[model samples]
Target: MTTLPDSFLSLPIAHRGYHDAGSGIIENTRAAFRAAIEAGYGIELDVQLSADGHAMVFHDYEMSRLTGETGPIRTRNRDALTRIILKNTDETIPALPEILSLIAGRVPLLIEAKDQDGAMGPDIGPLEQSVADALKDYAGPVAVMSFNPHSVIRLAALAPNVPRGLVTCHFPAEHWQLLNEKTRTRLRAIPDYMRAGASFISHRHDDLANPRISELRAAGASIICWTVRSFEAEIEARKLADNITFEGYRAAVGTG
Candidate 1:
């Protein structure tokens, strides 16, 4: 089994770069990422492949959620996407290289590869390939993870030295309903973390009590939990996870 770097377990990750729309610091924007770096927190962000095959740092397959534009993120090429403003802020969507340069290795970065099955089939390989290509020469504390096991496996093949993780949740949301039983079961069960060469696991904060997690923890696997919004939630997650990816409430972070 691959052991994750100490920084991966020690740092308090800023979910979406400590985003706060109320302050005009939109999630996945340059301003938000700078805030995390200035505050000395690791960053967790999502990336999707643009139409021209560049890795763009943004969340959701569609641009509407975080931007005024309403369309799939892939429809726009990198240059076009980089020029568009995000939400109501002055910040524009950033490319992966821009973010990597902005940080300049000031803190750790966790890149989540956003992908899913599409009309053409599993639409994750190209996304993984693009992300891998972007990070080829990035000399920083970094890791890649995905809710899709295939992406994780691909990263393992394409960039073996970079840490890989499996992001999972047991919640039965409506999205899971759309997946076939086999695919849904694989996602919920998360049986390929070890097989996929993942060095760590990032699970939903509320779903950390599964037996598999406990067994992995017992066997010395690194575990982290995500989107912890409250001090109370962080405390609960800390009992099972080695670290936290959090937002909303900032607490005194300990390296424990």
Candidate 2:
């Protein structure tokens, strides 16, 4: 297995590129990624496949939250997505390759392959394939992770040289009802990560107290927490996980 660079564990990861939409550095935009690079912090970003099979650096499955547009992100091609401004800001949606080129290995990146589309079993989804293709030629300190174990498994098979991780936690109340009992049980325990041969765990910050996470950490697996927003949460994360993926506060320098 390819080991992740030490910087990925030591430096705090800027969730969505140290973004501040109020300041026009919208999440996943080039400006946000540039800010993260300037701050000398690692970055954690999301990726989804576009209609034209291009990989895009975006978060929501829909464009409504970030952009005023009302449609699935994959409905628009890369050019059309680029034309849509993010939240009335000057920043437009960026492609994965564009952001990767902008970073140029300056800082490690944790790319979350969003798997909203049910990507169960062995078949690789288009998003996963697109992500693999985009990263194929890039020589950067990067890792791929996903809430869906299948995505991680697919990437592990496709890009064995790159580290892969499983993002796991108990589902929120709103999403809990959508999952069947078996799936919920599996996610709650995160047993699929082991089955998928994941090298790291990007767990929900609060859920690090679980015994499974401690076991993984004991076995020398990398453990990272997400969405760390406050100093208190950072303190807790420092205690349980190796690094943090943070946003909404001073995550770039660990002041928050």
Candidate 3:
């Protein structure tokens, strides 16, 4: 299994590229990524497959939330998506290559491939291939992960040399309504860590105390937590996490 780089564990990653919608720096847009790069923070962003099989840096499957446009992001081709400006910003939706070129290895990058199969089942591919293609020539401290184990498994095959991880959490039914009880139960245990060849996990901050997290860490998996919004939460998350993926507040370098 490929190990996650030190930079990923050391840097306080910017969730969704240090995005602050209040500041017009929309998540996964060029402005947000540039801001994160300027702040010297590692960037964590999400990608979805465009209709044409290109990887687009975006968090939601639907464009309505970020772009104020209608329909699923995959319903639009890359060119069309690129033409739609993000809400409250001049930046258009960026392709994976565009963001990769913009960052140019300046900071650690963490890419999460959103599950194309709403149920997080075996249906996955084109998006993983697109992401692999984008990173084929990228020289950087970068890693790929997903909440869906199948996606991580696919990434392992597609980008064998690139470090891979799982985005894990206790799948609370209310928050994970799309996933069935059996799926949630299986995922909560993170049974695919070995099968996916994952070197690390970015678990939900509140769920850091889960015994499985400690078990994985004891077995050599790096622990990372997501969406820490304040210094206090960062402090709490650090008890179990090797690093944090944060937004809304500046994470002091080297603070525990």
Best by TM-score: 3
Off by over 4 Å in 2: 119-124, 252-256
Total backbone clashes of candidate 3, pairs 3 or more residues apart or in separate chains: 0
TM-score of each: 0.94, 0.93, 0.98
Whole-model alpha-carbon lDDT for candidate 3: 0.93
Q: Which candidate leads the pack in lDDT? A: 3
Model 1: per-residue lDDT, tens digit, 189-228?
Answer: 7788778887788888998999888887786678989889
Off by over 4 Å in 1: 118-122
Model 1, position 39: C-alpha lDDT score: 79
Error of 1 at 232 (Å): 0.9
For candidate 3, give the lDDT of residue 134: 95
Worst 10 contiguous positions by lDDT, candidate 1: 115-124
Global lDDT of each candidate: 0.82, 0.83, 0.93
Worst 10-residue lDDT window for candidate 3 reads 247-256
> Regarding lDDT, does 2 or 3 come out ahead?
3
> How well is each residue in 1-256 modelled by candidate 3, as lDDT tens digits?
9999999988899999988888778888888889998888999999999999999999998888877799999999999989998878789988999899999999999999999989989999999999999999999889999998999999999999999999999999999999899999999999999999999999999999999999999999999998899999998999989999999988887652
**Candidate 1 vs candidate 2: which has greater lDDT?**
2
